[model samples]
Structures are given as structure tokens and as C-alpha cells.
Target: MRTESVELTVLCLIHKNGRYLLQDRIKNDWKGYTLPGGHIEPGESIVDAVIKVVVKRKKIIYRGE
Candidate 1:
């Protein structure tokens, strides 16, 4: 017997000053705009995963000032 697995992800609403940001659908699965998100890695928290994915996609990093 074999076990199947599924990856978990979280979608985030990026916004600024009452404006909401979204991503343009480029995949064949869905059409139109979508929120930014990615798969949750092993031993990674929801918050951490969100930040990591967002940073990777946006190419922005925080220095924790």
C-alpha cells in the first residue's frame, strides 16, 4: 500500500492605504487576478511561510529594524 500526500498553502491579501493587491493568473488552472501565496514547507509556521513566499515573489526583504 502507498500513502498519498497533499501540500498546504495560504493566500494573502496584499494592500496599502485601503488598496488591495492581487496577482494576475498565468496558470491554466484558474483565470483572472489572485492573491499571492505558496506551499507551506516542513516545520514552517503559517506566518513564516506567508512572509517567505511573499518575499520571494515580491523580491523584497526585511532587515528587522
Candidate 2:
């Protein structure tokens, strides 16, 4: 039996206040202050993933270009 694995990442665009908001790997993965984005789950789009992470963390909505 092969165990499938999924990877999640975060990408952040910090402001000039020297404040960075990224993700961190927890266990055997790259669990650290990554950017402000993550992997896309089934049925979830790329933009959705980023928005979820950023809004959930910073409590603000972003209108990406």
C-alpha cells in the first residue's frame, strides 16, 4: 500500500513595519514561517488558498491583481 501525501506552503508579503506573516511546517515538513499561501485542496482554486491563509492570519481581505 502506498500512502499518498500532500504538501502545504505559505507565502507572505510583509509590510515595511518589519512584520512578516508566513506559515511554518510542523512535523517532518518545512514547518516554518513560509510565505502567505498554501496548497490547493480538491475543488479549491489557487487564489482561494492564498486568500484563506492571508485573511485567516491577518484578518484582512486582499484584492490580488
Candidate 3:
């Protein structure tokens, strides 16, 4: 029997007016503009994961809905 591991990730789209927020990835492997997001931590909710990633990468804070 063989086992496979899966990783969960999330991406958020923040748009206002006619513009959307994105990150500029200058790394050699992946170089381009992408939305702010990252892999979800273990035992973390989807919403929480997205929030954490967004804050860490984009420096944006969530103020609740």
C-alpha cells in the first residue's frame, strides 16, 4: 500500500473599483503577480488560515464582517 500527502492552500481576491490587489513574486522558480495567500496550517479553519496568510503577506488586517 502507498500513502499520499495532501496540502491545503487558499487564495483571496480583494477587489475594489476596477483594481485587484496582488503580490509580485520575484523568485527564480515562480516569477509573476499573484494573489496574497498561502498553505493552511494543521487544525486551522479555512477562514482563519486565509486571514493569517493575508496579514503576513499583504500586511492587511481583518476587522470582521
lDDT of each: 0.82, 0.64, 0.86
lDDT of 3 by residue, 1-65 (tens): 99999999999998779999898999989799998888998999999898888876678866664
Give the range of the ten consecutive residues with the poorest summed lDDT in model 1: 56-65
- Candidate 1, 1-65: lDDT as tens digits: 99999899989877668988788887889878888888899899999998887777767564553
> Per-residue CA lDDT of candidate 2, range 26-58, in tens?
766665555656566777766677677677755
TM-score of 3: 0.83
Off by over 4 Å in 2: 1-10, 14-32, 61-65
Model 1 misplacement above 4 A: 1-4, 60-65
Clash number for every model? Answer: 0, 13, 0
What overall lDDT, based on C-alpha atoms, would model 2 receive against the true structure? 0.64
The order by descending lDDT is 3, 1, 2
lDDT: which candidate is best? 3
lDDT of 1: 0.82
Q: What TM-score does structure 1 among the candidates reach?
A: 0.72
RMSD of 2: 4.8
